[model samples]
Target: MSTARVWAPRPATVAVQIDGVRHPMTPGEGGWWEGPDLPPGARYGFLLDDDPTPRPDPRGRRLPDGVHGLSQAALPRLAPLDWPGRELRDGVIYELHVGTFTPEGTLDAAVARLGHLVDLGIDFVELLPVNAFNGTHNWGYDGVAWFAVHEAYGGPDAYAGFVAACHARGLGVIQDVVYNHLGPSGNYLPLYGPYLRDQAANTWGQEVELSHAEVRRYILDNARMWFEEYGVDGLRLDAVHALRDTSDEHILRTLSRETDDLSRRLERPLTLIAESDLNDPVMFRPRHEGGHGLTAQWSDDYHHAAHVALTGETAGYYADFEPLTALGRVATRGFFHAGTWSTFRERTHGVPLDDDVEAWRLVTCLQNHDQIGNRAAGDRLSASLSPRRQAIGAVLAVLTPSTPMLFMGEEWGASTPWQFFTSHPEPDLGRATAEGRFAEFEKMGWNRDVVPDPQDPATFQRSKLAWDELAHEPHRRLLAQYRDLIALRSREPDLRSPRLGDLSAEIDEHERHVTFVRGRIRIRLNLGDATWRPEGEEEALFATSDDVSGNPLMLPPDSALVSRTIE
Candidate 1:
């Protein structure tokens, strides 16, 4: 037997409909309603205030049908996992979208590929948002039911199995979650209470009403559910800067404090990584230091600088990152824009990371969902660069002084594009999304004509990774290079060191070569048209090219090498 509880503040009446049988719910304290006990797996929904149509539970654990359909009773709890656990520091992350990672695009199907990640030396597998969204396929961001797993991805049971499988293979899972705004469709929270702010809004529709006590609890509880119930190691908080809250204590601070308490109780390291555009170091600072105290935060500066240095595409936000020194600055310093001028926002942006802060606290990537998907044609860096250049990009990404994350197929340079795709069932909403995507790309200097119609089913299908590419020529070679670098990182204690003070780089602007030192190791990237032959006796540990062998090393243009000085 289970008790039904829902928070609907201003509703004159509230009722619970279990298995099509209506039962009047008694109004309780804190604007909550309680209903009679019911058996598990019962189909249920809430009916409020003279409205004949029932709304899905705001805290539903399962939605077998769809986001708009009746919610199923919580699935039976799985046996506790025997996870040995992994921590965030000095770890590598691989980010993937559930719908496109595999052909089946289900959690069960995704499990079949865990061995590949384990083999590739991935420490954490970061999945894009998987909460219940409208229709069959989406980017997973247009989720309305935050509590329920998307039924298309094999529901809650499959989610549990996927997490268990990862732990079994010694991998940690980081789930991306959105709390700033609900999707355009299937959002019934407004009918129940002030879930969204009335006037204020972010880039995505209305801002969540964090001012309300219950609403704050709702967001906090959802975050904890991933760690406590789902057994995830971490949560990649999506767009935390957009979470506008003017309360005495911000929800992020409260979440940090609560998560710390929960982490102690669970006896495992539970990480909170924020994807923030603010470039604020406060997100990862300890609460005692008057900061949010999150485990880490994504830094886009490295991605932008690396992209500009490699591709020479300085359009839009890449304008300020044009100089090769930008890459060097990010290599040594945590952020390239720390208290610097921004050509994109037309204002000084980002605070410098504190001296005491560890470099590993900033998670950076060369290619990610947003960087690749947001492109006009959803083209990847591999679409333009040669195999050698791709290797250089990998070297810069993996060997950087911070925690590094690789996008879905980035290791082998998967040719498939990760375009923005959605399946909003409402015709009007679909049309609006497609149009808005085109406009946004056009404003960012992208070719408007190349932007795919996000509503088209073909768009979703085209974005899927072609796993067969792994067995082929250049793909196999690049994959090996990535594996070698990861292995080297794991073997070298200096590579895993978190001190930013140990970092220094020599940038040859004309030669287009940059060498960064960490302990006794020297990593050099030759980005020019001519090869570099430095006069030195060094033990060559790893090089992108095979020709860079023996005492006098030859660094090929558009390739990188790692070596230690002969003492």
Candidate 2:
């Protein structure tokens, strides 16, 4: 027996409905109601005053019968874990979506492939959100239930086992958590109290009440439960820019401090990674310096710059990005658009980098969930470019001084199109979503009829990785390149940490050639229309072209090579 409580200020009387019986709940302070001693795992709901309709718990831990159904306190049988207590700094993060990672599309199914990631040399596996959303399949940015894990992904215990499996094999687990906004359907917070503000929704049609103490506590507690109770090593706070808070202390700053304190108290390495569009250096800056001291934040400027260079795509946000110029500045300064004019935004954006900042505190990637999954066709980098060009991008990403992330199946170039897909229960929502997806890509010159419907199950099935591709020629060769490059990053002292000050770049804008130098090593590339010999004197460590063996390096178009001074 346990006390059941809920914050329901709108109703005069609140009662707990358990096992087909109604139990009265006494009113409490601050718009909260409580009932004495209730069964934990029983399917329970709240009966408010005159309204006969049952409502699910706002802070529910489990949802056995989907989002619009009754809630239960889930008891997970967790396997013992042997965590290495590895820090975020000593990790190579691999971002994976559980539903599309394997053919089974469950957490337990994903665990069977953990050995593959371990063999590929990734220490951290950052999963997409597993929070209970409206659909069976989603990108997870539209999660509504903060505590409950997705029922289709083997529920809460399966998630715990997945984490244990990762820990047993020396891999740290970091998860994406959406705190900014909840999905439209199955959202019950507004019914209980003023969870959402009076203002319009930011992007996801939900305005979170971040300024309210109770609302803020709800999010903060969720963070604690994932890291402290669930044994999660870190959390990737989804879209910090959308969390509108006008309080004296920002929620991000507070969250960072809490995680930092927890890391020390537990005597284990815990990290709080944030996803911010602000491009501010203050994200990971120390609190004493008047900034949020988060573990790290992702910067899309690097992606914007690199993507345009490789794919030659100048649509939408890539309009303002000058690939060669941006890469040159981002290499040394950490942010190319830091307080600069943008044609895409139509206004100046980003904060200038401070000299004391470390490059490793910012995450950058050539291919990620967003870059690959959000596209109109959802084509991976492997499908868009030549194998040699893909290897060149990998060289730039792994060789950089920042924390590099790999999208799953990117190494061996899996032949699956990761199109946007959803399984909305509501007929109106399903139609709207399908229409909206085509309209978005239609404006970009893609045929509306050709765009795959997001509501279709086939779109999701097509996104799964083809594991059998590992045995093929180029696929096997590409895997070798990735393995070697990852090993290079691990072995080389110059590739890791705090090397921002020592980093420099040289670019030939006319020739479409750029070279990035970190300490004694340099990564040179030729993005030109013609072949050209690389300048300067250094021993070639790794080259994309097989013909690039001797000095006076004549690399073909879309080729890159890493070089270093002789030891």
Candidate 3:
């Protein structure tokens, strides 16, 4: 018999609307209202209390038109994943939002574009969250259904098909998952158990109750389902620091152990990458060593320093990173704010990492979703800097000591912006979002009207990747340069080494020039407007801006020159 359930803990009365007929639901002990014998593809919604409004099912798997409509259940075919190939550290990763990667904006369409990523020499395609969220278009951070893939993105089976296709093409797939908090809308976990807590808060809102036993199990099961059931090679846990847990055996540690067991059972290597603001090495340390045992974490220290130095604009969080010395520190130490005083936080942040830790333990990128989209108008480095400068940023991002991640269309330098967008069905939610967004920037002295409405359909349309731009001259040249740099990185032993001290940067901050040396190869960058000479004899291996073939090593403004030292 089919059953319908609604989660309304605080509400005294709850009713279900099925096929235009209203039926009173029996409220269970755990704030769950259930009705048996409901048919498949049932058209249902919840009526909370005496209110005339019918709310959409919080755990609804499929919303065809929008929220407050029929809930469609899709049973997707599950497949076994074989992952006995190259390690993540040995390859390049290209991060893409499935909705904006192509014109079709579905998993099947993304599968068709797998050849492009393969041809670009990318080892892994890290997709943004594909789980169902509110409305049609979103950033995917507000996903509610952790198990079911978005129906708009071709449902769960389509995701499985995409993974199978990626595996067939020898491309590893990493799914970005959010376990810290649920979306503002369509959140039902609270009614089931203590999945959310009122005590602890994160940047977004209330934190998920990782300290609770059942809640921990629910999250762990979700992670395993993705790796085992969905055939994803790795998981990128979003905002791990926001996960509030005071358990002696932390949920993260438990997740790592469970993933390890799954990997052993499947006889394949599975990885867990955390998006952590906490620069604690414990995230990468082994569980046996009294640590969380995550495989890797995104290192914002490297990105912040690199971005601030390159752009010379220090507003908001960038204010703490005005000096280029911070970039040099992260390059050589793996943490710029390693127990040092942070002007932004007014606190000493991050413990210093050991010099011998592998660079793959940290992922570094100059431009990612948060870096570009969180801006005033989602302006990318390509929008602010010249093509030559953009190429230089790419070179530094890839050639650095840490494992590099490239955003969608970054290699080709697409001009499109990846702005924050959402399409909430509730009018109150839409109005709240608009007011909240304006107020958020107003506190920072930014014009409130300048903040784009997240509910606008145009916002999502603007974020899509521009594929035709790839064929252009400057964009193609930059793409080729990125290809060659990654190729060299894969072949070069020194570049792959994780030894932090082995990496050194020689910079003239006043002159806007810097040189990065790894073993015998030297990467000379001239951010100055005039030409400059290197310290020693150097041959141009790669030039991002001007052609230095016949001309002597006189650097130009915002130019990059790579060379190998004479033995």
Candidate 4:
């Protein structure tokens, strides 16, 4: 028997369409409606009193047709996950969008590529959002049905298979989930209740109401479903700053605590990684330290500093990262805006980073989904920077104490652009999206005419990874360099130490060189045209240029070298 239920307090009467038959539902005490049980494998939709329109379930687990279609009872329960007890910090992370990770563009196809990641030395695989959206192709961020697995990605079963496949290959899975807002099209939350606060305005569609009890439960339940039902190892919370609430206990802390309790129950590490723009260390600080106790968060300061030093782009977010001293600041301290003046915001931006926070709690990446995908054409750093500079970026991101993330195809220096693409069927939404894409790039000085139409099939086709390029020339060399660096990171002790306070940096502004001293290793990079030499008897572990070897280390232009002190 299949039971159909829904929460609809605003409607005078509610009925559920089960197997094409509309059955009346009785209103219960908790603002819920209970209908008669239907046969198993039944597909259903809700009818709110004389209203003729069919509505999808608010807590629907599976959307087989599309977001607009009837919600169905998902088949056979997922088998228990055979976790290998691998933690998120055990090794490095690889972030990929399932749609573009393979030519097939499905979750199972992504599973077929796990062996490649395992060979590339990835311990965790972070997937972009897989929630059901109103399209055939998307980066998956603009999802409407929070509980549904995208039908294009093979729905709920395929996601489970993807997770199991990762675990089978000794990989932990982390999913990106947007708790801040839902996508504009096919949004059903507002139909049931006051899901959005009328007073609150967010650029990313309607903001969810935190004051409502059931709405909070809706999100928290979604969080639990990923771990409990789908067997995802961790969650990467998307754009947490947009979640507005004034409750005594913050939602983030509450989620962290709930995740911890679930972790204990599951006997595995279930964690939360926040994509916070706040730049506050309190996101990952200990609860005893008056923090929210989230496991970790992404830090963009490192990327900003590295981008300025490597690409020399002084536009957009790269404006404040002048003099290249900003890189020096982030290497020693976790944040360049650590209680300092920001030329971008025209005032102080970040709170003072506490002394004791572990550097690894902050995840740093040279290329991430947003960093590349949100660009006018998703051109990677490898597209513009020299091969030598690409190697340098790799060394800094991975060798640093902080946890590092590798975007898909980053290992072989992929040449494909990960441009934003969508297949919204509606003419109005499609037009609006294309216009918005063009308008967004105008501020960055991008050519609006050249901006690919997101609704175009060619746009999605162009973003697929080019696996054939990995065997030739510079791509092969870059792949080798990445493999060696990952091996070295495991072989070295100081580089893996998470204590942020112990690391220090010395920058030579005139010569354009920065030497970082952490643990027993010293990482020196020469960004100038003149060759720079190391002062002492240090052993070279990795060098981007051939000249940065031998007794007197004469580093070449755009070179990065890591050396250990001869004690």
Candidate topping TM-score: 1
Model 2 clashes, total count: 0
Expressed as tens digits, the lDDT of each residue in 204-257 for candidate 3 is: 778887776656777887888888777888999999988767898988899999
Candidates, ranked, lDDT: 1, 4, 2, 3
Could you give candidate 1's per-residue lDDT for residues 356-421 as a string of tens digits?
677899999999999998888889999999998999988988988999999999999899998989
Residue 499, model 4, lDDT: 70
Q: Which lDDT values do the candidates have, in the order given? A: 0.90, 0.83, 0.80, 0.84
Residue pairs with colliding backbones in model 3 are none
In terms of TM-score, which candidate is stronger, 1 or 2? Answer: 1
Best by lDDT: 1
TM-scores, one per candidate = 0.98, 0.96, 0.89, 0.97
RMSD of each: 1.2, 1.9, 3.7, 1.5
Report the CA-based lDDT of candidate 1 relative to the real structure: 0.90
lDDT by residue for model 4 (1-567), tens = 557878888788889998788888889987889988755568899998687877899788888889998888644354375674566663698999888888999998888888888877888899999999998989887899999999999988888888888888888889999988888688877777777887776778778888888888888989999998888888999989888888887888888888899888888888799998788987987777788899888999988898788888887667888777899888768888877778778788887665577787888888888888888877898899889998898887787678889999888889998998999889998999999999989876789977888999988988889888888978988888888888888878888845767888889999999889887788888888788876667788988767677356668888888888788
- Lowest summed lDDT window (length 10), candidate 2: 75-84
